[model samples]
Target chain A: MDVVKTPQQAAVTVEPPPGEPVPAIELVKIAKTFSSRRGIVTAVDAIDLVIGEGEFFSLLGPSGCGKTTTLRMIGGFEEPTEGQILLYGDDVVGVPPNHRDVNMVFQSYALFPHMSVFENVAFGLRRKAVSKAETKARVGDMLDLVQLDGKSDRRPRELSGGQQQRVALARALVNRPRALLLDEPLAALDLKLRQAMQLELKRIQREVGITFVFVTHDQNEALTMSDRLVVMNAGRIEQLGSPREVYEHPRTRFVAGFIGTSNLITGRVRAMDGSTALLEAAADECLVVPEAASAGAGVGRDLDVTVRPEKIVISEDRPGSGRCAIRGRVAEVVYLGTSTQYAVATAGGTELSVFVQNASDADDIAGRGADVWLSWRPDHSLALVTTQPAPAESRSDLSGGNQ
Target chain B: MSRSRLGARLTPYLLVLPGWLWLVVFFVVPTFVMLSVSTQTGDIVSGFQQTFHWRTYVDGWNQYHTQFIRSIVYGLITTLLCLVIAYPVAYWIAFRGGAHKSSLLFLILLPFFVSFVIRTQSWNFILSDNGMLLSALKNWGLVSQDFHILATAPAVIGGLTYNFLPFMVLPIYVGLERLDPALLEAAADLYGSKTATFRKVVLPLSMPGVFAGVLLTFVPAAADYVNAAILGGARTTMIGNVIQTEYFTNLDYPKASALSFILMAALLLGVFAYARVLGTEDVLDVAAR
Candidate 1:
């Protein structure tokens, strides 16, 4: 899919067929800015997103990357400086959160401390004036779903962190809103508990079939849970695609670096070999970027590319022909049980990371300071754009950031 | 290492020595002295003797039962008034005061810089008939020349409310101030209206503060005679005024001590009942934490 979708494309997505499924939430040209002591800071540059019904979507980004702000705008907790947030089909910018058909799970869990788990879960239903019997049955069912049925009478403080998180989930899901917005719900959990809750949350989402808009800075969390995820940076989306697509085919330098470890290389197109552009880097190093990724590059234009560590194979001898190969010496080696990571330093002062699966309990092919060859398929080389050609300094900064 | 362990064991007691000594010398001794005086029979001309006159309590109650009830009634009214007046002020300072929250809190405490009696005396001056405030109000037709506030029950209650207002504001402010803003957002996200959020989440969470403020303000306001002396007359005489009169004017030390003990007992009983009615142990646990 094309990254940075155009306004025309976004407009085309607004109206679905009469019988077709509609988007659960549509953020159209949403922009938020805040004036602080420093100055006017743009939190979320105008962006468009259409999250489908029952889709587990994530806005993944680092801190201060406008992911939480976007979720807040969708939940109606915050007013956008510009743009319209549509819940299902109705515009809900001026509507208060109480009037919106959405619920949020705060990062802090935010369960009412003074209330029992039953009362906390029953809060939304009570607000909606749900019949007492129905509210009890529904809250009871939700507590069961989250496996907190027996602890309904207990206060939030009495529960463990993971249990409290389940209570928070039950509280939001009890209302059965059109969409559930979760802001780093499991960020507070330990590694084991967090992984467990991730699957648990996914299972609950599937069982309830509610659209889940999860905001998280953890790339692994987003990749593992989201049906589709948007990678945001500096107030705009760098890319949006499935875990495989975003991981294997990141579209920008920021996305490539932010997702996971990637070997960044900047070079000028020395020549075009049919569908591949031969790139020449510092110290006469040669690499080939595919024509599909570096389409704008001619014989002399500059290009940037990234290759994932797992894609590059490290060998004791030079790799065979038909693959891009570079001679380097092993700089460092880290033995992970499943896979071993090797940092290969080329003569051009480029340190390319290569992760080779430890297929057997044998010694690694190359040890530290051993001469080795790193090679990857040309198709795996992803050309990156700083921002669709914005400015000179930023382009320089992009190259500066690659190393 | 053994010596260090011994020092560590004694550290807590050593640290507590000053406070323990202060309480014993000031509070414990005076309480024992008052207890003894309460059971003695006395006359101003012929000095008091330890005759175990426990009947003085019954006589004191019989003579001043009206004042005791009035004092409690005034205390309840003043507590309710303070809660009503302080909750919003505390809420405003907590949620809306923004950058000026500390300054606003400082403003609430500013009047406390003046002596308590001086403040009550100022209220006396302001509420006095044909005084500066009454004359000004009369000139503006806000009140008639026949209007009066001094030497009335309401003036005394009003004085009590104003004097103890900060005691109510500070604790409630602390409770509301410590409230997590995310909880409010969560409440809103759960589809709660503004009023419902305030009623359910904000009010219940701040109950600890209200309970604390009540404890802090009610006892002192109940035992206060300055407001009664300055802003009240015959009908408004509380147990505090009666105790003062028996202690200083009537020269009946036995009756004064006995009445003081009765007032303390009544206030204690009232507090225990209030705590039982307003708070369960669970709520108290949260409030205490």
Candidate 2:
């Protein structure tokens, strides 16, 4: 097994080999629309994606972002309204799910209630007309893989939620299809179980060496499990990259805020000097950020600057020198075990969040109403060209674009 | 404190008091009275005396054994026919009826708006030798002029099936309604063919409803005399018809009571055997889940 690395270390692209094998699955300009009482609603827009063999790919987005629909289209449970879906280079436009060389671990776990654990695991093999002895042996091996060897006779209801999830995984994997599609298979487990299953799923994927297409609304799960993931919004791909690449250098404001907690401050470009651009914000306050971050924005153009909370340092004494600095009064202090968070009200009437690690040095703790200085490197603050207002209620707003 | 505790303990029984009283008055007491009457020995005018006349039961069974068997056969056939006809209709309503589910169910029950006797009689007209159906068949050269469906086993069974169809449909609809559609998709994803998926997932999941429907249709159809009286000939006489004749037409209460007891006992035994054969415990367990 490869050593588990931080997101930055794991950011390398998974380029295909010199002579690439046919992609396990290819979705070309696929679109899906549903006509309901509310009229036609496009669930998935023109989406083109190629999943390499043995790649752990993820579709990460909020609900209604078409991630699950895209997964379903690949699984053959749904037909695309336009474009083509190819499985191993074969166009599978009208193929039924049963005829496709793929299996899905449904969110509901959908285990056959009438069948025992052994029978459930053997279901796909039996459908394929595998020999009885081979089916039994394969089922036993799968049960052992999922750590469910001895409880074969037990029914689904008799098992716990985590066990049922493993059974679902076993059932899907026993078929040994070219790829496995999982639709939030761990969503039902508790927090600790979900975390455990995330690592377990990655381990199982590595062991089996089959392409895995996972769909989830949870950015953390996507970051932790996917080799490369696509962030989608409003039926379109917002950004696609490795977790570190998408997180560290998000190309769009939506991608920036969706992937993690970001502080977006809108301002107009006041001056430019090489890679540094000076922006005049509200209340005569001027901030400097990397000009390369908002390269297309000339002078007098409005742009948004995003800085992560952890990147901001809060100090009671004014810092001597920094590329970017803001004076604020601490409005709230939140102690979160490993870290302490402060919501600082800036002089420009904007609140900037700062996260400080809870080390043994208690000198950095800022109390409510304390005057403080928030500072970070100019490179740490990314300037984005202001785009259309982001959808409200995504919890992405930093200061006053829209509520 | 003790009195209050006692009141709390008695609350459940108090709440069920009305239903218990109704059952005892309408069902239990009448059943015991009939049992006593079945063992009585006397003419109707002599004020029948309870002499423990076991011979009455033997005599009733011996005299109408063929009719008893015939009633069971008709019940079996009616139940089977109701299942075959109701399953697909119920499945469609449960799965595909969508926004019109309630209205489709109402249509299934539309026949109940008219009287059951009228409905059975309406079938008598439809299946008569010179009825519209026979005439149409004759014009289409599908049958001879003398070919008739009325006054036969099929006619009586058909009437029973039509009358008890709602009983079969409603339970199965309830069962199928409770199914999670994802199970079928999962089966298909697992490489199960359409027919195999239906047989493995859809059929087994809907068994509880089928069982309930069968019980509802079979028990009542077995003891029903109206359909046989209206749509059957003398050769198609069931045990229910003989019991009715013994009491109302022949004025023989003892034999009638004995026949009724036999029918009830036989039905109870049949239901017990059916439940045993199908592993009712497993069905109940799955349905409960």
Candidate 3:
């Protein structure tokens, strides 16, 4: 009942007699291409993913990133143009949606407008020819679970958005499918309601113990609700890990930039000393990053040294230490409720963003044009080898020698 | 300022004035004149007078009651036949027409480009004793030489069905077009079989179009005179034929007016009953108000 565990931990503990239980849903190089007048559009590239049973997994990305396509393929709404999809051990390649043991909570909710809430919940049971009494009992139980017990006789349109959303959820979960697919089900709700529904969905998923594959373009929603998330870009997954891992230690420059704000300083590896690498970031400034961060790149390879704004400490006075330090002038200061963000232009012409927490007693707000020093630990800076050649605009703005 | 406020309040009425005026001149006046004529005693040669002869209604009904029953029965059969044929056509065009939906809808409307009387007359040649259909049937030994269809009730009913089929198709197509594809997918995902989904989801949602189609086809079919005149024998004479005869051949204006009024009343009563049976009174109520 403790829903706070990581997906891996939950997967491990929930399946009792297991060294490695079969995944609830597995995709093997599944690809989908739509043919239209404009020509071929690949919505989902060949991608392999394994979602563990009872894990709250998320496919997170910006729009047009194929997160929804991946979820629909799992739900049997869209057939993969190539490769295989396995549901628990069975390959459900040619199976229709009705035959698949999966139910989806669509973004629009897609509740039957003509049916009352109770009838909508009981539709699946009636389709299976369940007895009338059993169908009624199950529908009542589901309505109670979704906290819509007394409102079962009301039509979908007569209910509020949140109530209708719960009805959709109840209608899908009442059948207890093997896996539940959610395609931005909370996107239509207001922020406060969406946040509440996020917890409610998590609680219900825990109670039912069904593997949930949730697709969303909202980064915050993905980070908050998912135990493990795959950040996708252009029909392919950029990175897959626990939310904390993907946030704190992003594997790619795209992941670093997309998950949250990161100041990407372009550089090339200059030297390596044990666990540290010297990155020539600008004309006169050399940044020391963890050598392990650039482990896959050679000495001369172009790399991006990424650091979160919060990791960089900024102060008017120089912090005299062995930390990597750059002196800059505060170009702009943005006052956020919990933190102050400073846009600092370094003497080397590279702009560094730094966030300072606004603790009650810490009232030293750096004003614009204030000369300051930005410093961070070498281990905090991550060096990711650039996969594509740096674009000319980005390369010319680096202000450093090619070496 | 008060004058301008009055103008602002009266703007909507002013905008609707032309339409109301047109209805009053063309429809309301004609209907009122017809109502007065229905209650009058008259001969076409002299003139109709406002005699308030209510007995004409009872006398007309007493004489031509069989024709009235035949017209109602033909209307019901034609509407049912149109529904049976049009539902599949509308479903196909709406769901499966894909890139050709507009062209398919154009094809449904193609018959309207021809004159209605001309098309009904064409069925005469097709269903005649020596026509292609009967000739082929005779050649195949499917029918005897004496077998004929041109002047039968079936031919008249078939003509009614054919003439009003597009009326049934367009409204049903509109209903099916407005249906969200996601709803059908949701039904399938919820374990509904194709037939069950059609029966429970598609049919219920398309009721508005069916109701509209039925009204469009039935009302006109019941009052149509040309089909009964051309395709029906004397035994199959409908109320429309009797009304036509009283007006033209017999020159009994009072009896024709009475029959016309009775037809209108009967149709209105039928429509009301139909609405009640289909539980579509809400749609009608919204439309009426």
Candidate 4:
């Protein structure tokens, strides 16, 4: 069977129907700083990002990472300090949010409280001077699209959170903007509703095929909804890639730790050749790291290595050749239905976690306090340049080799 | 289990008891007394023996014809005028005041720091004949030197509007302040122009505040004897002045009570009628919020 490209993977080259061929929206070196009595604070640092025609891209980061600020800049709600925002390739710098061809679904779902659902959806069409008959038909169609045909006369406050969210979605989509910017659209929902709405949002995006630039702090949400995600930290793009690529081959320690659970090891370069490098682990043990780049360290320059817990094998006996092995006492054991996780403590007083899935009728690995060997192939380990110390202090001790 | 059930059942009513008591003591009892006195033919001082003379309403009506109607009309005009002026100011404060919002709100409320009497008296100085304002208007070719505003119906209306403007401003400001800005931006993204966004989204959503403000300004303005007594000529008399006269000068307590009851009934009926037209129950709920 031939694989079809998802909206995230598909190139956003096709123009939206019924419009002049132009770039949907563009921002060049956008920067925004807020100055108050408290002092000047740079909310959105000098940044550049392009949202193309009919694309579903996402900016993923924690709060205060400037993702929402970037979206606000594109929507013309906030004027860029030193950059230009272009809609359809035209500099939209003094154009108000109303004039911009973009819309946003706020996290709180800001439906007009006094207007009925129908009136709310028809607001944009009426503004555009569309005929009354056409407005009725268009608004009716949008209501049906959002599965709210029977609720046209109902006020927003009367609706449930999920229903209000759908009404907000229909209201924005009825206008048929060039792009839809969703700022944590599902944040207000409970877990179950949020999960359901994620799929619903994906389906809606597929059906509409409009450019969607979503902003979210949730890594799981971004991974599920986005075709490609830009993981951001401290007002800079840390990495941008497909979910699997970014998850498996994270280029930075932040990306590795931010995306999913991983075991980290800090070591110093002992020796290096063209293909592989030997490193002295923090536990006074030597490790052979494969596919490792030369650190140009003579003997004691420190380096960091990241290995996933699932990649390590915990057994009474060492498994295979060219695998880094460590002897440790099992500190704790947690059986998680499908997988068994063991926290093993090495002689260096660092605790390392090893997870192995239950694939066969083998007895469970050792209990807490049992001595064992933790092993993983050198190819599965990564030797990284030791840059700044761990950005998060909680993960610092865990990064020192065996821990 | 019995204790738990009793607590659960009584807690809600207990929580609501204070407000209910307040309403009964301050509102319901006064309205009942007014109703009784309105139906009495004789004055309250002369034992009225529970005599039900409904003609008192008619007499009250006939005695104050254009003045009663004029008071209501002037109140309506002042309320409408305040709404027109306040919506934009409230919108600016609510949606665009950025960081200095508390200070801006304080400024809007600053006039209330002085007593209403003081505020009304201040207007006297400003709008007095040959006052600085009159001189400025004459200098600017807007009014003649002989033309004055302190004794006219327009002066009373102006006084009423100025006195009650803060009342109108507060509710509208509250409504506008509570508005979720993203909703406006959402409307804009849906292809609404600034005017359209305001008209369709911001205006309708803020109507609850408008409704409350209208009620606050118009009801007080309609019943206000102070502004009319201070700034109005005999031609600018309102129903409140009539009631005051009947109570004090004429010593006809029953007739004054009858007039007060009639005004209160009219206000209630008007509010109900407005709610029906605008489908404003939800707006009122939001206003309360």
For model 3 the local lDDT of residue B231 reads 85
Per-candidate DockQ vs. reference: 0.85, 0.92, 0.62, 0.63
Most accurate candidate by DockQ: 2
TM-score of chain B of 2: 0.95
What class would a CAPRI assessor give candidate 3's docking?
medium
Whole-model lDDT per candidate: 0.87, 0.87, 0.84, 0.77
Q: Which stretches of candidate 1 lie over 4 Å from their true place?
A: A1-20, A281-286, A292-295, A388-403, B137-146
DockQ of predicted candidate 2: 0.92
Clashing pairs in 3: none
Expressed as tens digits, the lDDT of each residue in B34-80 for candidate 4 is: 78877776555666646898888888878877777887898888888
Taking the tens digit of each residue's C-alpha lDDT, what string does model 1 give over A94-189? 777877778899999999999999999999999888889999999999999999979999989999999999999999999988899999999999
Instruction: Put down candidate 2 lDDT per residue, B1-289, tens digits, no spaces.
Output: 6999999999999999999999999999999999999999889786899899989999998899999999999999999999999999999999899999999999999999999999888988988888889999999999987888888898999899989999999999999999998999999999888899999899998998999999999999999999999999999999999999999999899899999999999999999999999999998998898
- My TM-score estimates for the predictions, one after another, are 0.93, 0.92, 0.91, 0.84
Question: Could you tell me how far off, in angstroms, the CA of residue A58 lies in candidate 2 after the best superposition?
Answer: 1.3
B-chain TM-score for every candidate: 0.95, 0.95, 0.93, 0.88
Candidate 3 off by > 4 Å: A1-18, A281-286, A291-295, A347-351, A385-403, B132-142, B281-289
Instruction: Residues B1-289, candidate 1: write the lDDT tens digits.
Output: 6999999999999999999999999999998899899898758898999999899999989998998888888988999999999999999999999999989999999998999999999888888997899999999999887999999999999999999999999999999998999999989888788999999999998988999999998999889898899999999999999988999999999899999999888889988998899865766777765
lDDT, candidate 3, A341-403, per-residue tens: 889998767788888899989977588898877889877888764455544533332222110
Ranking by DockQ: 2, 1, 4, 3
